[model samples]
Target: MHDTERMNSGEIRAGIGLALVFAFRMLGMFMVLPVLATYGMDLADATPALIGLAIGAYGLTQAVLQIPFGMLSDRIGRRPVIYAGLLVFAAGSALAAGADSIWGVIAGRVLQGAGAISAAVMALLSDLTREQHRTKAMAMIGMSIGLSFAVAMVVGPLLTRAFGLSGLFWVTAGMALLGIVLVVALVPKGTGALQHRESVVAGQAIRSTLRNGDLLRLDFGILALHAILMASFVALPLALVERGGLPREEHWWVYLTALLVGFFGMVPFIIYAEKKRRMKRVLGAAVAVLLFCELFFWQFGNSLTMLVIGAVIFFTAFNLLEASLPSLVSKVAPAGGKGTAMGVYATTQFLGAALGGILGGWLYQQGGLGGVFVGCALLCALWLVIAVTMREPPYVTSLRLPLSPTALRDAGLIQRLLAAPGVADAMVVAEEAALYIKVDTQKLDRTSLERLIESAPAMC
Candidate 1:
């Protein structure tokens, strides 16, 4: 077979296509976060607590459905389910955009959140990319989301002026439509799509994800990350309008600056950590930064500069945690359950978000900044503890090997390949093959993989 046929994937290109779809949907969530509460107060029947509920309601639905939807994608089809979810989300956005009362907005927000597709996206990327490249593909989607969240914070207000609230929904609808086009035009077909079976546990993929301890740690990290995020937004907008002296129309600038500076600030350290194999240390430092920001918000958020300083630190750590957690999850998750693991992880994240908003509103109502900060600090502290204990996963690589029935009979080859140096684990699955090659990053020998494959092509 030719090199192209042997590859069985064009991971980098296909990964980009998948990342675009994810970025669009994240923009949908991020748009309202930085300004929603302050402006939302004008709607008839609005209340402080009611506004907080609205801020978090979307996550409630997303938390509930993320895993189920992902499992569904394994059965029905990724693109079709995603399309349906988008339609529901767009309809909900339109409903909120046109609402005359606070209740209407809440209802619409619920519908909009039902479009949650993060889990399905992860699963689909796993199906499409080779094992060695799967983590990279997942990283692409994660980075897209981080960049989108940062960009949207800065752009939402500017966009609001052009379209108004009604425009936000309409634009959301239009974005969904565009996403549908990408799904149709770009997403590569998956081999698993043809025989993706339905069962109580959805087979090995989900079973493995459920049993992983490392993945659980990462999951806890994400839960804390988003819980604090949604809770902060519940109060930040009001803080800005009241204490910062910023008009609602210009609030995006705060987000724009914080997101940009924080996003850029994180790059050097992230690269250093990843290259030097010091991920655990970097991650610990990031969590510490997040906790410090929470304390800063609690103590000195009496002025715009203080809020902005707090926001810069908050989002810098947020971006890192958002992207790194998934990559870390991939390292620990069971083979083929990339989707299910992410689904569970995302559900936890959304649940945290919903709880954050609900709890933040209640806390603010009763005890103000001290209550919220104490709660967020507890979350960060929990993650920091987990991060410190996390095992530094060796560089694990995945590969795809095409197989037919005839190849299954080549008995000893699979076992022999697994015994090779640097090969920690191997799964010579039918139709697809996976290997978790533990590598010394500084001295990886590509030739071993090639030589091993050449010696036992049929078994591989």
Candidate 2:
């Protein structure tokens, strides 16, 4: 039976299954953020620069490995790919847990990134659902990511308080193992294998992804967002310990407060944007808020309360942009190249993480918090300018069309599709009868799309 025919609870649960699996993977990385630098100064004879390298090594490796893992999932099957990744991640966590030196931890971080399963999970999600409900499925994954990030901020410091960073690693290992169970027992298996070779070629896929002035803007947006995020953390603990007069033991309260405020702050805006189709407007407002916050942080971080306020605004905009960018990618990417586009996007995302860590550390070391915030302010300004240039993303839902014999046999179908007013692009895989089309919301005519498919000549 198709996923739509299943009970709503089951469908939602399936989405949850994917989300939790993703969260398990992400938490391993995020758990170290809040407390590591402060405490890590002593462990493995680390300085801020080495700590930053340890923190970012995962992204460096993840950027390199994510696409290959996803492609492997298409061929070997999602379940196996995920299981292997999980085991590998667990092994890395175990190594980090027992590390005697900074190099050992860095090596472990690299191993952790090597276990890239994000693409596989996404591909599995695509297989488990009908095309119409794919957005909903994807939304679940996105929400989980945000939620996990928020949850980790509050929980990470507390975990450190309870058991130290090594304990965090052990816990991360346990979570990865739990994911193995979820994949094997809960996630349904089908076309989510690792053999989708066409998904990897970076030709039209890379060109389309790169040339889109808007997508590049968002790419810059995320790179800027993550850069600020990493930079802030680099400065935050030192600020809290040295400036805010907070002990390392109590830092979670600040994180807990900022995260709660930020998550709540972004939600209404997300709802408004989606319901009213004001994505561009909402996004613009959010970016402006972000840039101002960076400036605010630069001016006001000397005061503890002002720093808290700045943190809230920074994260508020961070959450909003994180949620919005993927939506825009879905709206803008060529339907035939979504996977490829995402592959490239993922690479950029991880590259951002790595760059953020490296640069953020350098800035913090050279000029203290002021320098870091100045860098963040500059990035936010660039993102603001870039985002301001984007056309509003369409609110129309995407539909994945499976190929039929008739649709394939028609030599002129691609031409007919190009002629359709609302159709942006179409890719018809004759053998698979899988058709991918993007509809322009301004000119959307659903009946025309349906009728064209119904009337097409023999394809098979």
lDDT of every predicted structure (CA atoms)? 0.72, 0.77
* Poorly placed runs, candidate 1 (over 4 Å): 1-18, 121-140, 185-202, 205-208, 403-407, 410-415, 431-444, 457-460
Question: Where does candidate 1 clash, by residue pair?
Answer: 131-398, 132-398, 132-399
- Tens digit per residue, CA lDDT, model 2, 123-241: 77766766556677877888788778877887888887898888888899999999889877777656434222123433446766788777777777776777677777777887888
TM-score of each: 0.87, 0.91
lDDT of 1 by residue, 386-417 (tens): 87888886555434445445445557656776
Could you tell me how far off, in angstroms, the CA of residue 61 lies in candidate 1 after the best superposition? 2.0
Output the TM-score of candidate 2: 0.91
> CA shift at 74, candidate 1, in angstroms?
3.1
- The true-versus-predicted C-alpha distance at residue 223 of model 1, in Å, is 0.6
| Predictions: Cα RMSD each | 3.8, 2.9
Best by TM-score: 2
